[model samples]
Target: MTTLLEGKAIRKIFKTGTVETEVLKGIDFQILEGEFIIILGQSGSGKTTLLNILGGMTQATEGELHYQGQPLHKASDAELTLYRRKEVGFIFQHYNLMPNLTAYENVKLAADIAEHPLEVEKVLTDVGLEDLKDHFPSQLSGGQQQRIAIARAIVKNPALLLCDEPTGALDIQTGIQVLMALKQLNQNYHMTILIITHNSEIAKMADRVLFLKDGIIDHITVNEHPLAPEELTW
Candidate 1:
């Protein structure tokens, strides 16, 4: 497996007045192409912050980051924007779809911005939302809306998919359905995916699991045989 992303000694800090809070402290890791990775941590543990940095939405305060040998840590805002638009896809816990737009329209909006995008209809079908493509977000169930959001992200044909607490807003069954969809995307598209969630059970479906404690990775574990979403509990 080839390395798709790498981070070394990464750090992030926020300052308000004289008070400074360090959120990330010297984090390091590598993500392989076509691999599914899980970052597990409680709220305020900096999991989402790390995911933001990895996706180029935010810059690290210190250290180095590279994507396919390109220096992300040194990239300018314009460069980061291009990287995000061209190479990265993001899915958040909240489905940020436009309430007025239909599922197909939401996905198409993202596809239109990509340099090499997949067919919007095809991606919607991939996420099992083809029949609901004409429905507005409010008309759909939470899981259906989330699948639409996933379709929106995947339609861009991004090299990397970054998910922040993707299942955080759903019931157990609905979350499982979403996880299954994500797993299928990784297998069928051979997409490299990084997911951050406090649900430790979700780690069983990952090729590699990273445990974050107090803004640093406490340990890393690789699963020889990753489980399916249905097999996960919690």
Candidate 2:
């Protein structure tokens, strides 16, 4: 597989007056095309911060970030905006759906802005939410809402999907179902997915698992055969 994204000596620091705290310390990694990568870490290990930097949601304090050989770290604000809109899709722990919008509408909102969008209804059906298209967020359960969020992100037909604790708020069964959907998306669309979570069990479903400790990658393990979501146990 081709290298889709690369990060070299990435670092993030926050400055509050005279105090400077570093969150990422010389992190480096490369993501291959159509790969499913899991980033595992304890809380405050900077997993989310790394994901944000990779997705261009924020810039790294120091180091190089490249996407398909283009320098993402050097991109201007407008370029980053375009890159995010056209190439990257994000799914958060929270559904982040509009309460007033129906499931279909929420997905459509993202589809409308995308340069190359999948059919909204097709994506909803892909996530097994065809019947819930007209339902609002309040009318759905946590898993159902998350499936809708997945649909919203995938409808953009993005090159890379960045998920931050995608199953953090659900029961095991529901979380498994969501994971299965994500797996299916990666399989069917050849989507490159990077997921960050504290749940170590989720790592079994990934092509590669990156262990983060204290803002640095401790090690990377590649699985010869990743298990399905149903086979995972917490």
**lDDT (0 to 1) per candidate:** 0.94, 0.96
lDDT of 1 by residue, 13-87 (tens): 999999999999999999999999999999999998999999998999999999999999999999999999999
Query: lDDT tens digits, residues 1-234, model 2?
Result: 999999999999989999999999998899999999999999999999998898888999999999999999999999999999999999999998999999999999999988889999899989999999999999999999999999999999999999999999999999999999999999999999999999999999999999999999999999999999999987
TM-score of 1: 0.98
- Quality of model 2 by C-alpha lDDT: 0.96
lDDT of 1: 0.94
lDDT of 1 at 64: 99
Look at candidate 2 and give me any clashing residue pairs: none
Tell me each candidate's TM-score: 0.98, 0.98
The residue-level lDDT of candidate 1 at 170 comes to 98
